[model samples]
Target: MLTNEYLKRVYEGLEKRNANEPEFLQAVREVLESIQPVVEKHPEYEKAGLIERMVEPERIITFRVPWVDDQGKVQVNRGYRVQFNSAIGPYKGGLRFHPSVNQGILKFLGFEQIFKNSLTTLPMGGGKGGSDFDPHGKSDMEVMRFCQSFMTELYRHIGQFVDCPAGDIGVGGREVGYMFGQYKRLTNSFQGGMLTGKGLTFGGSLARTEATGYGLCYFTAEALKCMRNDSFEGKTVVISGSGNVAIYACEKATQLGAKVVTMSDSNGYVYDPNGIDLAYVKDLKEVRRGRIKEYAETHKDATYVADCSKVWTVPCDIALPCATQNEINKESAEALVKGGCTVVCEGANMPSTPEAIEVYLSNGILYGPAKASNAGGVATSGLEMSQNSERLSWSFEEVDAKLKGIMEGIFHASYDASVAAGSEGNLMVGANCAGFLKVAAAMMAQGITY
Candidate 1:
């Protein structure tokens, strides 16, 4: 399917080297598919061997994270840090502390981070690190000990301008607080830029928590306006995942006059035709960490579907897959298209399969890729980094306003790039081409050793 002969050869080599890393391979293939126009435009890239270097990580660190639980037994977890590319800035990404953390997953995420961060026009490069240690159901003390052990090994490899990390799935304010504390304790110095998503009592930003979800809606609004001369106003939205991204996206969509009808966790999804309750959802997921199925118990009108992926089946004008990877498959995509979804925006990395994206694009749906739609989180993190460096904090309103502008910029960048590449309105291709141009230029300018 790769029509470019040069790209085909590069992808084959990349495939052979990273055959076991399906997620990474998938990420690379998606970018390659979009960059054919760029390759044809620039022979210097091929001469410089930039594509081959870009696919391969600059360095990868795998370490052992051993700690004791509340039961006084030793548990071991594998930790990974894939510094995929630093052509633009320091290796910057989140630390995901989940059971699914692996090299392939991190590489996929890190590779995506390169473009996501680049699209933000920020000075941060791409990197991702995490462990297979699930923080769920663990006592605070137990979690703290594991974070300390994880930081003990992670401290040496990261610094302010080196490779800064923030929070990701299974890692939040509490986890960040623990890890930041450990990093400080281990270094015996105040490293303000060491970790982001810190507690408010420390150097954390005000709008950091709501940035991603709010930004997703902002991007969606721009996409709607660009393609249909529309907005989130009066739209019906169905969003997957009850985590931070999903909840806040629901909140922002409702604020923009859209009715968010559904939200889900791993257990299942819940549909409330009357629109979701934000205060209740915030307490349930953010405070109590309760399952989304409990929404049905609390609200008599809502229905709880036991199948998580079936969240997409709920009828809506807009569909936001804010959940895990490959959440929206071909069947789910068909269901959304058949049900009359006009827009599909991703909040999670690689949340949609290739087939699902094809369905959205071929159906003339206004589709927003994850890199452009979900760049708000890292953009806010970058803002926090600037505030830290300046030893000052911006007001919540100031940060939120900046985030909105950046999201709008991202939308236009993708939309304009797609138009320029002869694939008018294909946001996936537009975003990939737009984000790649900046990083590719930086990499080429720095020479082949970069």
Candidate 2:
């Protein structure tokens, strides 16, 4: 039901051109659908063809990364950097090193980054880059060599005021350290601002590791408080993925008086009715790099489930899908609702499918889209960028406070935009519309740049 002709035409054109990229198309469609009300209000966006321009990337860099493995064998991996937009400022996003990294996935992430970064009220525009190189089970040297090879090509495309890349999924401090070291060596200059999520010895900001997870809870707490006059206190929470986002989200929620009952990995999920031990989970996932089933083995009170998606059936007051995209579908959403879940906040990009989102919205569940709820990581990255430029590293408390303020601001912005758009509590529409307005305005201001 796209009533606006311009929005409909743009979406149709996107479908025709990007029919093969379902992830990208889905991201585009979701935003376009949410912004219909905005389009109706602002006809000038249609005249300027803002949606069409915004949907297409500014540049896409794909190259080959060849490295020597521990066995002294040459291996080649495809690398990509999609500079989706820079109308507002330099391109800022994470470099994911998962095997699932592809043009479509990166495009979807980069497209979402444009709006996500916009929602942060930071100057960063959207862009995402990564390779099909999987870091799992790789030796330290092998990972280092691969990261060096990746940066040898990536260094040329990024700069402090150009594009700043951070960590995501398979990429972490080790990968960032390796890549930054290589980038510094190639350029023969120490441009700390060129990357965030660096090691503490470098120009990395404190609380950077916990920012996303902590930020998710902050945003979710705000959503609950504002919408339902509730908080995380005394609530049961379920978080997917035992990675940085999920683990820290669990920590923050527990600190805020909520008991997180479950955490999952790619292989499976662990349901601990007694609440997860953040220390033990961290040791297993971070240090040991072990599967989540280990938690069940260690804690007799916990039960291990083979299917990760089934984590939804365990039931909770709030659900945070910090795992990969589309991890939760319609059925999962139904289970969450049936389990008495009232709030759904995305810690990962597009974690819920369209059907899942519909279930949340139709069921009166408060839904916070990834762009707004998860922008904390990037917002803190923005803070890291500021610290880098200033040659000063703020303490963890300073950075965490700033992150909390930014998340609160984003929630209010999205809430207000949703209300103004006649969808008072639909955060999906609110976040999309609010994020789009800022970037669209910037794009319109910049005029056609062909």
Candidate 3:
């Protein structure tokens, strides 16, 4: 633990900053709390002012994006790009598009990405950007307009060897296409490697959408093997969210011989006693873009709950929260524990609050944090960048194999770090410290720079 005097000084310095973002503060607090021991052990890092630099971003770009709607009405939205670090390499992260996006959330995500990207053993730094634009219910023209406007400001700050952005929560293939198109028109160059998660025709790799979910399962498989000497075969699993990550997780879990029983979206959840069919889930979420309630309509044995928060009450051996941050609080964690869940893997960023994590740790349940577990998507994106650079693409099977290897390697890295840090089995702290130490070392070697 940090000395009371040291913490007080740190808190005072934090209070004086103009950017007192709550989400960013929360993320920093989590990381700092976990790494206090490391701070004490490594006096050289403290002397080098590593933690101080780690708390702040290198650059933040904010701009207004103006677009025209279908009705000839002009719309405007705020945009942001937080280049959190570049100690390892150029900035590399996702560009989110959602109504809830803001500087605070983006900063927190970017800060986390610094460590997460480092853990992948790839030459990529941390960055994140997004806008307060809601893509849902928007026409293709509106989305295209917004993407073009966004890329106009963004293109100036990004490139193939500099910064590469990919899709996140609200940004999908359509959004990537729009942004890439605008970038091409302005730069007058293809430069396909400047972005990832593109359409297959343009340069996107196969199984990129499935990377995160399949990677989640692969990491969880490693954890299970280490903890219980077992695998996913015949184990019952429950996953939340109907997005790309959730659907892919369901697919991977089913392929690994687990019976996934329930999947949910913001509206509600569908509990299928006969195990969720991956084909039906893909059709509903990907093809139809319908609510999870549609699942219950087709599968008579499944029960649909309109309120998603209540879905945790269903029983399962493993729980995969692939939804938003802080979705599973103490109450939800308790419900999951009561339902016989022995493992909880997060596919979403910070899905479990600190309270919920405490509950899991105290109960001796195996918990996988998002930074360490959900890295497969970005890892595969890095692979896509490699392919683009080489002017070649690997087959789906080859890419999937590489993704599995990376996930497994990350799991073992986190596990070993946890054990060595004397917080054996406490993966959250271990992962944060492992990732932070690497970035901090790189920063120190490079020396201080603006």
Q: Which candidate's lDDT is highest?
A: 2
- Which is the winner by lDDT between candidate 1 and candidate 3? 1
User: Compared with the true structure, what per-residue lDDT tens digits does model 2 show for residues 225-327?
Assistant: 8889999999999999999999999999999999999999988999998999899999998999999999988899999999998999987999999999999
Supply candidate 2's per-residue lDDT for 415.
94
- Pairwise lDDT winner, candidates 2 and 3: 2
Residue 168, model 3: Cα distance from true site in angstroms: 0.4
Per-residue lDDT of 1-450 in model 1, one digit per residue for the tens?
589988999999988988899988888999999989988999988888889899888999999999999889999999889998999999999999888888999999999999999999999999999999998788889999999999999999999999989998998998999889988988888777768888777899989999899999999998888789998889999999988899899999999999999999888999999999989999998888889999899999999989998888888999989988889999999999988898999999889999999899889888999999999999999999999999999999999999999999999999899988889989999999999999999998898782
Model 1 misplaced regions, further than 4 Å: none
True-structure RMSD for candidate 1: 0.9
RMSD of each: 0.9, 0.8, 1.6
Q: What RMSD value applies to candidate 3?
A: 1.6
Q: Per-prediction count of colliding residue pairs?
A: 0, 0, 0
What are the runs in model 2 whose C-alpha is more than 4 Å off? none
